[model samples]
Target: MKTIAGFITACSIACSALAPQASHADTLTIALDYDPADLYGTLSTNNPMFAMLESLYLDDPRTGQVEPYLALSHEMASPTEVMVTLREGVTFSNGEPMDAEAVVHSVTVFSNPEIVPAYGIYAPMIDSAEVIDDTTVKIVLSEPNPIVDLLLAQIIVVPPDYWEEVGGTEGFGQAPVGTGPFVLTDWVKDDRIVMDTNPDYWGDLPENIDEVVWRTVPEASSRAAGLRTGEYDLAMNLPAIDVDAINAEDGLTVYEGDVARIFSLVLSSLDIHETPVQDRLVRQAINYAIDKQTIIDALYFGKARLLNGQVVLPGQPGYDPEMTDYPFDPEKARELLAEAGYPDGIDVEFKCASNRYAQGLETCEAIAAMLGDVGINASLTLLESGEFIGQYVRRELAPIGLIGLGVPNDPSFGIGVYRSDWRYSYYQNPEMDALIDASRSETDPEARAEIIRQASQLLFDDAVIAYLFGAQSFFGHSDDLEGFATNVAQRFFVHTLSLAE
Candidate 1:
């Protein structure tokens, strides 16, 4: 198997060229599926934000290993303590020096209970942060966390002076500043965002690309059309249905890679509204009613794998092989529904986003049809990608929501969802919480895996959410586009891309 970097290098060399000379155009336009919600923090999984922000460590998409990025090196002073040495002369786009103060502020902002509440779930192990010197920072954890380094990889650094100058999180969300290869020059919500290359970047040079334009093209077919007509240099999240045709088109190329993202129905564990999904039997029956494999075969074209009730799939650490997927059986579904006292049927809403996932709308429609067969009335509600993300983050969706979520880097962070305070989580179990807590601090790899496996088994047996499939990502771009690849986190590494001859 090729490493993520090796795969990207191979694609850059093999891609067919459209012109004899490299593209001289200073601007590169990319079409994206959704409009990024917030630029303040790394909580949003938007690719555009990644182009403008820098994390302490970068994770290899192929192998879940941490590579030093902004931090020169990190040393564990003790099991619950870590000291990091920052790279010298780093500066944020707002003309503020990137030092220990900035790192402490950024980490503190993300972990604060009152702000960006969801991030608290991801960084609960962290207790406090202090500046040891001008270029060094110390982190004190509440308890020993085996993957604290990996967890910090997701917390991006920002300038404290600029953050307060502009009204904190509210202003930062509108106009963001970061220490990255690209700087945000212009942003028009729901339409497009423009970025320019930073000349004073302290990292590796020869970046090649000058300007980037992320335009919102919500439809897969439309994005494909733009790529073919030279309206877009690259298009992201192309529908699986159009992958073959796009590849066959002249002057165009397609890049495929593995992603940790999983598409499934997020069931409300609590009775947020008067809905049938609150019942465990009803949730299990809904899972059985939908044929997940058939959807993959028909819609995905075999580009996805079945997700058997676990966030991290097989081949990753702490995966439970014995935990089984709920078999598709409409008869069994109907029986379970009747047993739960919904003999005649139950009415519920199935909410999903149109452009977020490949064939996502079609998948929701198919699920609705399957529910109909089992005497469950599923009202399909489709929202635009931006609107869907907003509703999702606010926890304002209906009883059942179709969502794609993942833990691309480490399973330890993925298991954090078991915490009762997890923003998107509505269910809580004492035993599962204890297991997750034990796994977080376990020094032995094998022992940690077993603890995680037990927690996964408990969640799978509960059947709170309808575990679906892990979908592959297909990126379509002009033949001249080079050095373009997506990591398992689904963030675009725009700095690596250039228009080659």
Candidate 2:
């Protein structure tokens, strides 16, 4: 498990020729799937805000361990208390010191439901954040949370003075300032975002690249074309069908890796939707109807790993290896549908984003077709990335939605969606809720793991979601591109990117 610093060290030693050089290109143009609605990192969970904003800690892809970034050290004072010390001498791009006060403000704003309503999905665990000194802050939790450190890693610190001077989140997003290696320079809505290197950065500066341009190119074909023409130095969310062609083309390379995101169909068990998916039998039928492995082979080229009945992956804690995936039994699915009172068939609205994930649309279409074979008539609704995310975060999607749920090291993070208090949760089970609650406060690692495992089994037995496969991210870039790496969460450290001279 290599940290970002370790990656840089290895690059310098072995790939010295590809290291950042003054002679390399100054501007790096990359094509992204969607234009972010705001630069405020806390406003939304899925966005390219990491390119400019720096979090206190980051997850190591291989190990799933929290590694310090802006934070110097984080100590668990007690079961319900956390003490974090910020790295001194670090300053936001606006010249404001990134200190305890700034971190406290960021934490407060992030946890506030009024400010970020979507945070209700992962209810505010932090009771309050108080500054102990210029470099240290104390955080008191509402209750004992086993994964408090993982939750704290999501806070993206902002300049407290600048945040207030700009009149809060809306204005601050217009011209965001962060302590990252890059600073926002220009933003054209629905078009492109430009960021220039922060010369006064606290860490190692981006050596060769001076500016990064993220152009909105939603179509996979157009992004691939841009890469071929040298118009885009790198392209994200490339389709699996195009990987072979891109790799065959001279001067182009396709980098593939495992992403810690479970692409599944979330069935709404809420009565507000008034859908057949509200029935547990129908949900189980939906899970058994589709052949996940076939879809993975057709859409992801067998690069993705099949998931069991839960979102917890194989490597993560609480992942039960004994659990087997729902087999592709169309007859069994039909029987379940009949027992659920839908003797002939049932109609469901299937909502999915066109380009949110690699080959996401195609995968959804394939799943819908398979469901139809089991007498489940699915009406597929294709939406753009922004609109899809907007509805998803607000819990306004249709009865069934195809989405990639990003999981962290903790099993609690993935199973959080099943909790009754989560605003976006569609299903509610008091038994499951109690199990999750027990896992949160359990200090003993063994006890927490057992609680998480039990919770996962409950979700599986209830058929909470139609589990698909773990996501595999494929990034197409020029062969000359170096230092490009992504974590299991599918977030790339853009600061490490440099062009080979």
Candidate 3:
């Protein structure tokens, strides 16, 4: 059962303090989607897998309650306005002062006013970013944007000194500099990425490992093969089918866990899931046709949960418990298909990322087979992480596609993905947005709880997308490796990891 008793104990962490230091005996080689870039705007959204080198003005992981990261403290002067005081003495990798005006200008670019996340489009948000003083900035909201601070952290900040050299918005990707724990040494596209520890790292340091070498292994078998030959000590993008073999191998361990993201089959509401190529019946039949349990067992080897509620993880403060997961029923799926005007069978193509979240391809394959039973013919279109993000995370609707969201550990940010700005094509809700608005504003725990429940119910009833399951999170290391958090936000506060030997 992979005893999860440790999870309960993990919550006791002080949150701010680093984990106990472990032996830094050797250098670590990490396998990631692809290499990262020196320029903030040029890098892939999740590519900096080596976040140590690139830094953000605010660190999103820690301070879910108020705000944490470079900003020392944040105060809401008004529900629609906030005052942020930057920590004193902090400097970018370029050794420039971390000031409020610098913060404002950096954001001016991230919001796509200038250098934004690569393929960074959209005119940008916020009525304005105003600099009040050397270390303080006041952000005024166009509306009551409660998660403003979080959005700030996700938008990686660059040094004003280096940013100006990028020639403002037009040529920012030419060269890059950041204020992270690591420094980008080299990037050779699909070949490899090399990074070294930022000696001036503001936070505590890793025990002894000086650098991280991250490489890309596109094929699942190739990734598993690399892991087998000791080509990688730790790697991402592992598929579900290989879990058993990996476990039986010597000197290697496979970490398992439920990712916070949700994978749902979005039924276009433009016609209420009854559009030309898709229909409500097709969506419902898909819900029935999908053998979610089989995927969890046969493919994921029972490393995940079968879920149905609009929201998956419940430990989060605002989660609702009464909702039920959609049950598995192929017969019902067939019946739904008949009702959807396709009794014999229908054909459709589904899009998915070749490698991103664990088992991304397998999950889509399972969906395809289930759809077949429901008389819906389905095909798969897989792309790399960069390409997938350009389509899915940005929520671009082309053909039906698969997406893995790294749902924030916090409930608010978790729900933020469904917000109108991020809703893409399949998502659009007036009442849901109203409820979300209420939930964000209602400070009283009880009232906010009611509001969240209502929003959850709205998503559930709407079945905005077929709710999948939550990942059964895991972390695998050598027998000596200890002190790592087993939760979804698998952070690297390196001071805690130690080698027993």
Candidate 4:
């Protein structure tokens, strides 16, 4: 890929046609690194189509919570039961009624892993659901789980008729339908996704831009170049190489987004759930050998921030300030290795993804050098995201590679990923499991946050992972893009975006 030159904002677009309601054209052409997968019922890649731009649900990113989207209000039936009432008279983009049964079907579909593996985090815990009325749905969790509210934020509720019309899960992916703010027009892989505003959209339309075109600008420089040339209006993961130029551009702005992506170097021992990786001394030494701050500064061009814990963003309620990160210390690393019975060094194979995380391959290479100094012969192997995730959940099959969050979202996400059962490092501890259970069941925010912190401390104590850095979803767009605000956890909600003509 060609290295893109610095940004130069060009006011060349003919906006007259972009505006549907405004005096000028209102189309916003944004760019993504990859195109969204088929927005089928549940199998779509976590595309902005179903999560942000083209969709809406009961999520309030401000509080790290999900409310009701098409649903009017949700009531607590019991400690482990949630009763949701759909907004009355809501219509799908195709003009179908979005009622309670539709919500039930969506929920049921999400509960099945065979439908969407990512949704399994939300589905596995659901015990059952009862269709209380035409507009009301009640979800009963196996336990008192709060993440259920967060899960609803992106699980698009489809019209029951739409699924029946399309056949089933297989058909749903091809002829996708949703009650979101926009309707899919066309999708070309590694190209662009065109979406027209839902004419029958029940909620508020983005005031600045009408239609949204999410493009895939494969290279960081290319993405930045497109933003500068007026070929694109919003760009994700603008190359760190051009941060200042973007900030200084006349019509552009460089805003920070949460990297919600995490990078780690894990050592999965043969036991599958109990490896030499669970050694606190080994894990801490690995962290000592590597310098996280340097990587963030260099790779991110100072546009990114170093993060810790699963909850790194400041806005998230459970961000524990006390959960400090280890500073870089080669000497300390050597000491830990010696203490762990490898004074000279230990041979270990390290694996990472080529393009999974932002600059993941580079990260693995850098980490290997650090480990070399500590007498750990680290062999770096890179894999794509699919094989990396599959082998990780299975354990010992995949190299001790770095993975961000096993589950989607936050602490509730930690339940399945960091829990003892997940075998993150062949680690299993009763205390860890008990704390996870307590946090999941706790209704009070403070109490739950404390338990989450404890769980984090437990994992940290065991050195289950060579904690490297937190995810800061870094992206760039025109400064004038309204409704764009950086939350604590670093998720971008375009529903909050507005553009000036």
Candidates' C-alpha lDDT: 0.77, 0.78, 0.58, 0.63
Cα error of candidate 3 at position 117, Å: 4.8
Rank list by TM-score: 1, 2, 4, 3
After aligning candidate 2 to the native by TM-score, how far in Å is the CA of 28 from where it should be? 1.1
TM-score for predicted model 1 compared with the true structure: 0.91
- Runs off by more than 4 Å, candidate 1: 1-24, 61-64, 117-120, 205-207
lDDT string, candidate 2, 1-501, tens digits: 333343333322322221122332488899987777677743355345666678788765544477888898888898778899899999887788999999999888877776752333344677889999999999888888777667767777888877776567765565667888877656677788777777788888755788788899988889988999999999998888888999999999998867577888889887788888999999999999999989888778878888877677786667888888889999999999999999899988999997777788888889999999999999999888778887876677769999887655667768877787675577888998888778777878888878888998888888988888887777899987887777766677777777876
lDDT of candidate 3 over 135-246, digit per residue (tens): 8888765566545555555545567765565454333342345566655555566766555666666776555556556676666677677777767666665666777777
Considering summed lDDT, which 10 consecutive residues are worst modelled in model 3? Answer: 11-20
In the range 235-291, model 1's lDDT, one tens digit per residue, is 988888889998999989888868577777877776565688888899899989999
Q: Deviation in angstroms for 308 in model 2?
A: 1.5
Give the higher-lDDT candidate: 3 or 4.
Answer: 4
By lDDT, who's the top model here?
A: 2
**Backbone clash count, each prediction separately:** 1, 0, 21, 25
Runs of candidate 2 with Cα error greater than 4 angstroms are: 1-25, 60-65, 117-123
In TM-score terms, candidate 3 sits at 0.79
